[model samples]
Target: MKAIFFILFAVIAGITAMAITTEQTTIEPLLTEEITTETITEEPTTFETMPIVGDEYCTWGPSYWCHNKTTAAECDATTYCTNYVWSENTKGL
Candidate 1:
């Protein structure tokens, strides 16, 4: 009788452990992409009027004020270029 009780106790403990261990779970993706295709029509709020200068090509140099309105024929007629072209066109002697 004692041996039978021990065996029944062991089976009940194993069934209780298995019941406590069994759990449902859900897996999810790491990233979720959201698609948007709405045309955003932005109205012009501010106006930046550039002072119109000469329509000639200006020498893009240190002293020349070659801006957007000023063409290539405007400003100084020197062959010197602006200092902004460092990596793009860094020429040497």
Candidate 2:
């Protein structure tokens, strides 16, 4: 019957169209570039001398003592540092 022939022709046309479209389509991975970062930092210094009077040393209160003024300054620059010098408490001579 003419209907059957028309159906068969339509099916073949649709198959051919699909095959052509699939061949024309491309699938490829995206291109990516790698990135890197580097940093240079200086090490902190330490002091070896004993504390002197009238000189301001770094301290966290009545306890911890920092090496020197510079070290105290660095500590104070941070979020967890307070610099102070304790006045010597002595009695008679």
Candidate 3:
């Protein structure tokens, strides 16, 4: 009778240990998510005009045009017109 009781107690202890280990086991995500990123770049637009003579001017500051080179230079110096260009002949040929 003592031997039978020992066997039953061992079985119960083994089952309890198995249940505790199962509960403590870590669970992994079934579906792992991968993240990806992309970068896009665009070209700047260009302004074109016909050539002229003696009517020099400068293009600067958000599509603004200056008829004087000095003013254009000032705008450039102030960083207001970083991409200034000189155009000729406002009065046309």
Structural similarity to truth (TM-score) of each candidate: 0.25, 0.28, 0.28
lDDT of 3 by residue, 16-82 (tens): 9998887656333323444345322445678898667534434334344343445645445323333
- What is the TM-score of candidate 1? 0.25
Q: What is the C-alpha RMSD of each candidate to the true structure, in Å?
A: 21.3, 23.4, 25.1
Clashing pairs in 3: none
Model 2 misplaced regions, further than 4 Å? 27-93
Please write out the lDDT profile of model 1 over residues 6-84, one tens digit for every residue: 9999999999887666532121231343434542355558988886664433423443443321431354422333434
Which residue window of length 10 is worst by lDDT in model 2?
Answer: 84-93
Best by lDDT: 3
Q: Arrange candidates by lDDT, highest first: which order?
A: 3, 2, 1
- Please tell me which model should have the higher lDDT, number 2 or number 3: 3
Candidate 2 lDDT over 1-93, as tens digits, reads 999999999999999999888765632222233333432244558878987763653434423333344554455632222323422331110
- Cα lDDT for residue 75, model 1? 48
